[model samples]
Target: MTTTDADAVRLVLEGDAEAFKILVDRYYDRCLRLATHLLGAGGDAEDAVQDALLRAYRHLGAYQERDKFSAWLFRIVVNQCRTLGARRRGVQALHERAWIEQGDGEPAEEHPADREATREELQRALSRLDADQREAVVLKFAEDMTYDEMAAVTGVGVSALKMRVQRACKRLRAMLTETNHV
Candidate 1:
């Protein structure tokens, strides 16, 4: 976490309610990116992150000072993504197809063809993961959270979070390889 974020969180906890806006502003984009990757769309990810932010703001007093605020926020986002994922199970096939089609059109100048292909392949693989595994991967790679922090937020054992991340990595590697992109 950045010093600014930590300070903002500290301020919010100390009853300076407006300080929470700084935290939200700092994390919103990152949280949205992670959520979009996990939830598989801009709309769903935005919705989930917004919901998580509201919950986090409401429960700011409940947050422990010992925990990293970023990790706690990620946990809330992950849970919201899981709920969205569960609701999306039946439509996953359509969602996957749509995601592929939508993702295939990345700007060539911004991302080379090979890079775009790799990104799409990885996105598909990520979409294939179970909610927990996906959360583990996103939090580990995208947020760069430690196993202990992930465990604290996820309410799981550190070993379990590590195992989930390992499994997710292996699965992602296999999927990418199968697509001849790894």
Candidate 2:
């Protein structure tokens, strides 16, 4: 049987520390993805996620069962990213390569070099976005989250999140167009 998140949390709180690893294992990839998009670099994102996961473990006692554990943990990740991102601003170049490379092991449907160029172009455009807008876009589209779920993680109102996404999309399109023309 599949163990639910709530069950894992209960096991952890009930003194089974190893149970916590289950929770971490389940959510680690998602947390890393969010952090990577928010922080805009794999190394920074990894550091932020490690700190966030540590903080989550330390504060596990305060976690209430009423809230979904993923949302609660994501809030921590978002906050950590914000703190790290502020510290990193101005020190990191705007055009730094920010994505983590992944291979699916399937035969290539598209030319690898062309795919890489397209990916780099998109990353450049994303890096140009305001942090808030980028977060909104990443959560909405990249992470495939609903507005309600995003609001829970980000603590931003649904309408505001919608506006950010709309603006981000418009900006990304313009930026991508400008790049293609050059």
Candidate 3:
């Protein structure tokens, strides 16, 4: 039986702490995907997700009923990503500069490895995007979220989120095409 997020929350508040597992089970994969895309599937990415989940668990009582549980949970995840991004700002800046200078990066050093190379190219291109554009793209395309949902998670205006997504799409396309992966 599919449990509603509100029902799960109510169960937890009613002293059934195990009920919170429903929410975590439902959202964990999605949260991990977003975190991996944003932080490139490394320890940092996993750490960001763990930190967000911990914060959500600790502050579950503070979650107001008005917002969708996902929006609130994702807000926590995004904020955690932002903090990680800031800490790794210099590394990302260097990577972005190198991406632009190299024009889609060096060759794969092996020709027949098509799918893995394509995925790697996409990951690199995604990492080169500014933090906001990366988050917007992950939310809008990868997560299939509506603009308002994205805005709720990000606390950005819908128009701004739209602009970020549009720009990200354009940049991603340009990078992929340059790499001959598109």
Candidate 4:
């Protein structure tokens, strides 16, 4: 019998702290995935996700039933990534690590060397994007989120998020093309 997120929340709030693990188990991988993409593959991504989870646990009382728990948690994860990213200011290396760590689910028939080169090229292209644009792109494509869902997690307007994604895609294409010529 799978307990719903709201049920788990209620259990936690009712002093059953162990019930909180249900929420963690449900969302940890997804939160870690987004954090790893935003911050990188190293301890930074792990740290961001850990901090976000702790924050969520601490502020569970603030969670409203009206909002989807996943969105609320993602908002915290994204913000935590932003805070860590700003502090480190290691965007280039971080982006590269993030891309490489995000393994492509390609078939074994693909040559490993070719796959690595493609990953590196993509990493370079993504690294060139500004923070906002990068975040928009990662959330929209990697996370497979709709604009409305993005707005809920990011606190950004839908139209602005759409523009960022559009601009980021265009810039990434241009950057990749330039690299290919070089």
User: Whose TM-score is greatest here?
Assistant: 4
Q: How well is each residue in 109-128 modelled by candidate 3, as lDDT tens digits?
A: 33454656555666677777
lDDT of 3 at 160: 98
State each model's CA lDDT, in order: 0.71, 0.77, 0.76, 0.79
- TM, every model: 0.75, 0.82, 0.79, 0.86
lDDT by residue (42-126, candidate 1, tens digit) is: 5888899999999999888788867778888988987887787633321111111212322245322323546555566666777
**Ranking of all predicted structures according to TM-score, beginning with the best and ending with the worst:** 4, 2, 3, 1
Candidate 1, residue 31: the lDDT equals 86
Every model's Cα RMSD, please?
Answer: 7.3, 6.6, 6.7, 5.3
Candidate 1: stretches off by over 4 Å = 1-15, 86-112
Q: What TM-score should be assigned to candidate 2?
A: 0.82
What's the distance in Å from true for residue 12, model 1?
3.9
Q: Can you give the lDDT of residue 53 in candidate 2?
A: 91
lDDT of 2 at 39: 79
Candidate 4 per-residue lDDT, tens place, 86-129, comes to 33333322222232221253322436567666667766667667
Query: How would you encode candidate 2's per-residue C-alpha lDDT over 1-182 as one tens digit per residue?
Result: 98999898888889999998998999999998888777766588889899999999889989888888898999899999888863333212212122221234332243555766767777777777888888887787777788998999999999999999888777876776678689
